[model samples]
Target: MTRDLKALLASDQTALGTWTQMVAPELVDLIGLNGFRFTIIDCQHGPFGIETAENLARAADANDIAVALRVSRNDPVEIMKALDAGIRHVVVPNIETAEEAETAVAATRFGPHGLRGACPCCRSGGHFIRNWDSYVTAEEARTGAIALVETEEGRRNIEAICATSGLAALMIGPFDLSVSMGLNGDWRCDEVQRAVTEMARAGTSAGLPVIMPVFAPTPAECRDLVDHWRGEDVTTFVVGSDKILIAEAFASWAAKLS
Candidate 1:
């Protein structure tokens, strides 16, 4: 069977994913083969067309890494296209209410699970390899739906959003949240910390893992991030991304040259 993140996280194991902002499917395979259990294609900020995103998803799956498409907005088409293309998990940005969360979750499901349009011809559904019943059931079993609540309104509605059904995780877009609170880039402010902890607590209360992003550039920093979130109970995040890794490597090379 293909690697499934929802299945893995169900066992209380950490689900480690990398974010891709560039259009390279090779990076997905490289990170997947190395250690990352999943990849989140950044359609929101990245220059990703549907074809490229689909190819990226396929490459990650080929390498046994689950794929999560950080979709563009909360639009159903964006979510639908990602799901139709084989991405099993979706992290939606700027969701601020339970109703928005409900819509996002509904887009990921069909019939009793959600109101997603049915079509088995997509690559993710094996290009109609399975019957409708089997496909829907299998997809639902393998899929995870996550909501990114980054604004203060989202912060206030955290509990209700987390409590939404068919929603698997509540994610923090830290920088956006910081900016929303007028803290500039100073995400270490006490207010930011409090908001993050509130999100974690709300997820815990709702029986879901709180998705976090740890932007460490070195082994030591990654370890520090892990230690920092240890008390939060939930364990999963986009640990780092190609941009950070490449930036670190480039800076080291520049230092050597200098």
Candidate 2:
């Protein structure tokens, strides 16, 4: 089952997770076994497609960890495909307006409330074994969408975007936002910090969990950033990524040998 990270965050719990660009299902199992509550499959920047996402979703379920997909863009087709592949939690990136927010949310839902196409036989629906009523009910409870605010325009419309209904959370994309604002990816810039604070506050006020990435190079720095954001009511975080961790470990081993 998807771990229901949305519900966990709504309960005011701090959920920390990592990102994975590797196309291996076993990698997701490892992340879960290591005690992470969730993992985000970086489909947008990574080489993940629908098939790979399906396998990763299964791995996450087996390990009782929520698997979130960061779609390449805020496209309904891509979002719908991920959902059908059993990715219950989705992070749509580059959302710059309320309409984009609405579109992303709608793609996660079925008709009447959304525009998702029906696929009872899809993995998300249990391959048609589960009754329609039971399946729809469970799907409603499990699936959720998180909009990523990564650009200056997104920051400007943060309030309206957060106000969109059916959003489970908001993700502050620090690096992209900084670059978009002409800071050249300097997320530590005072202006970037201000924008991040405003966005996080808006999402919190809208009753949505706000997720921010802690991209520090050391554990101490990561803790510092987490503590700072915890005071801002942004409890959910992506502490790091599998790629960075692997590279860091390899570098540490080489340094020790040298």
Candidate 3:
């Protein structure tokens, strides 16, 4: 059976994913092969462009792993391009209001339901026009947009953001959220923790999945952090980015050589 984010979301399992800034599709295949359930192609902060993201989606499909594209912004064109590239999910960043969340979700749907532009020959439609009806239905059932709320204003309006219609998930952007609150990017501070708890609570109250990153450098620390967030109702965790993981490994190896 094909792996799908929808299945993961509906299940009670703790889904794990990684973020990649590198533009190589092989990295995505490796992520899946290494047992990650999903990978977010980090176009917002990473170096991914439309073409590269499309290629990454192909790799994810080959590996039977769920993939989400974090668009550079919550623009309709960006969302539409990600979808056309065959990515089934989008993570929209910096949403501070229910209206913004609504806009992001709306870009993922078609007519009467959304403002997404239609393309019968897009990669999402199998690059053909023969099965348009089934394609539309499948897209409606499978595709969704996640809201990344990570600012003081966003924290204040998280409940409303989670209340937005058709939002697939709520992700707490810890570093940005801390910095936005004048904490100097200290995601470990109490203020940031409280805000994250509140956001997770709001997400649960709204019946949405909550996702947060566990940036701890050690396996023990990562486990502790996951346990901490799990207590707050966070269902998904992104352990680290490709760059961070590689850099850390390189440093550890160099230390051993010394």
Using TM-score as the measure, the top candidate is 3
lDDT by residue (1-258, candidate 3, tens digit) is 236787776666788888978988788888889988988998888865998888877888899988888999999999999988888889999999999999999999998789899989888877886977788888878899999999999999998999998999998899999899999989999888888888889998899988888887776888899988777777688988877777888888999999
Instruction: List TM-score per model, in order.
Output: 0.93, 0.95, 0.96
Model 2: per-residue Cα lDDT over 1-258, one tens digit each: 577776667756778888988988887888889878888988888886878877888888899987899999888889888888888889999999999999999998888888888876887766774577777777877888899999999999999999998888999999999999999989988999998999999999988889989888777889999999999888888987888777877888899999
Query: How many clashes does the backbone of model 3 have?
Result: 0
Per-model CA lDDT versus the true structure: 0.82, 0.86, 0.87
Q: Which stretches of model 2 miss by more than 4 angstroms?
A: none
lDDT for predicted candidate 2 compared with the true structure: 0.86
Which of 1 and 3 is the better model by TM-score? Answer: 3
Tens digit of per-residue lDDT, candidate 1, span 33-108: 8888877889998987778988887788689887788888898788888888878888899999999999999988
Distance (Å) between predicted and true CA of 52, model 1? Answer: 0.5
Record all residue pairs in model 3 with backbone atoms less than 3 Å apart, i.e. clashing. none
What are the C-alpha RMSDs, in order, of all predicted structures?
1.8, 1.4, 1.4
Least accurate 10 contiguous residues by lDDT in model 3: 1-10
Question: Which stretches in model 1 have alpha-carbon errors above 4 Å?
Answer: none
lDDT of 3: 0.87
